[model samples]
Target: MKRITVIGSGYVGTAVACLLSTKNMVAVIDTDKEIIHKLSKQISHLDDPQIKKYLKKNKNNLKFSTELTSAISKTDLYILCLPTDFLVSKNEFDTKNLKSVISELTELDPKVPILIKSTVPMHFTDEMNKEFNRDDIVFSPEFLREGQALYDSFYPSRIIFGSKKPSLATKIASIFKEAAKNSPQVLFSSAAESESIKLFSNSYLAMRVAFFNELDSLCLSKSFDAKKIIEGVCSDARIGNEYNNPSFGFGGYCLPKDTKQLISQFKDIPNSLITSVIQSNEKRKKYISNKIIEKKPKNVGIYRLQMKEGSDNFKESSVINIIKKIKNHKIPIIIYEPLLRKQTFLNSKVMTNFTEFAASASIILANRYNEELNPYLEKTFTRDIFQEN
Candidate 1:
């Protein structure tokens, strides 16, 4: 019965708090009133139904608070889950929140080990350790999907700890493994290596996405079956399967920023292909939008604004770029996303029914294909190389 306080109530933070609450005394903290309020009800803001179900089954151990200082009081472990949004002006991650939160926690409790699950710049933890004069700090990167945070936590593929101390690393890994996996991996390293692990992992996934998207662009241009080509290629053991679906571009929170951050780290260093990966994603979106324009469609309907399927996040989403490019040609656009109950998205009228959305638009652009748009397949414009929903 350890008292664990988790800061930041975003997707990753909420998932961590929910998962830890299964057997420990967990207090979730966030500055956002709505998020704290929702967690007080033992509910998840991720829009995932599993959270509600989990909370119903395990009700007594979880709580929410907005007061950071008080939440850290008397807690055995402090988890930092703040957002490190990619700042376009700086061309680097805005880690201001992470730095501030860590400083506050150290001032409040100097001895408490702070596990940072937030995505940060490479070697940030090592720098922080030097500045703070403490060895209790650690880094553990999270691979959470927008709406599937808890589900992924319950069955994480791997767990890596960025701790210099072997014992501390083992302690953190054991807890997570006990909650989720049978024999979860527990890799230990310096702060710099841990930070690189997260960035490199996401960048690789982005590269995979960019690769297939460019293939889709080539297929569309030459009038070939892009799906068959991908199936044949991915069938090879070297490529395997997963994340093979092509879309507007890779535009979730982690991929876009992480890829650019990796490239940014190479600003002074000699590099060609890493820089090209970032540029390629931007070019891919522009190409897809240009293809949509070439169809001579006056009205375009976006099936969903989210970056991927089963995700509630649209931050830095590629679909937004496509919309802007298409709208530049003065084409009217509509949307059909059940998650968006509002009348419009960025001024485009929201069409609730698939049939209505399909009927009104000359061309419907879908990032991921679905059977709901089956009847209008001929009129649908998509770069979904894997035809995966």
Candidate 2:
């Protein structure tokens, strides 16, 4: 196995770092000194219990640090798993991290094949190659849930590389393939085309979510059972019945930004719904907040701010947006997040004790339903159609 280095050390980077450590000597380079210190001790800053276990088991091969020189000097392959957040106002993804990592990698070592695992603006790879004067860099997107990052790494549905050098791409793909639990789809392409593939893929999933959400919205408006309609529609084999669950909106690290980035790419193009889908998500968040507000509650409790179960991410969690919505409306907010060790969330009281939160809340707004709040089930307001999200 070849030596591997992962930059960023967030969810994606951490997952990739741990997974590669199973077969290769892996060192994660992060600017976050605290995170580096934790990883250095074979401990994960993440709340996931499984993550810590993996860190313990793979302590021999896994190492982490804040030094870029040591990282670049140690590994021939560097994975740039930096943040590529959506620029909401700009309607594009901020590829500043990817750009900076590529430049840094070149300054460190020109021969290292850096695989960009961060999502980017379409044609980013094309422009980057021209700017940096390197053909060794490649774009390989990651598809991982926040909480199940490592598990997904071991069982990735696909491993795609955006490199014209099919032979070299195959070598990179082989690294992930050996570590993967199942057969992974390894496809090669021009960096520009691959970047488009990642954006368009997420956009399509976002569109699917929006489609089902509108269906739920229509059902709610007409007092029709959403479960019945969804069941009937998904009964068709053509639909395949995945990503069909409805929610306040699609808000995570990827979908929300990816859809907007793709829409921005269509600047001169004639499109209405593509743009409307983005608008609809915002409208949906507002609409849900309004619906919860009509209850005339005194103190509202937020039960689990996670985007979905088994996911530790809340980067653009819809529930946090709900908190922002109710803050100025005179209703005091308390949050019950098992993942949090803080006394508060943003500014709202963080109730580690469910009993206190449950007793004080006039109503609880959960983006996704959880049975843990069953003691105050009557006070809960959620649109969990299938109770899956």
How does each model score on lDDT? 0.83, 0.83
Clashing pairs in 2: none
Residue-by-residue lDDT tens digits, candidate 2, 49-144: 667788999999987889878876668698888888777676677887778878878888888887888988877876877799877778888887
Q: Please tell me which predicted candidate would have the highest TM-score against the true structure.
A: 1
Off by over 4 Å in 1: none
Clashes of each: 0, 0
Evaluated against the true structure, the overall lDDT of model 2 is 0.83
Models, CA RMSD each: 1.6, 1.8
- lDDT of residue 95 for candidate 1: 86
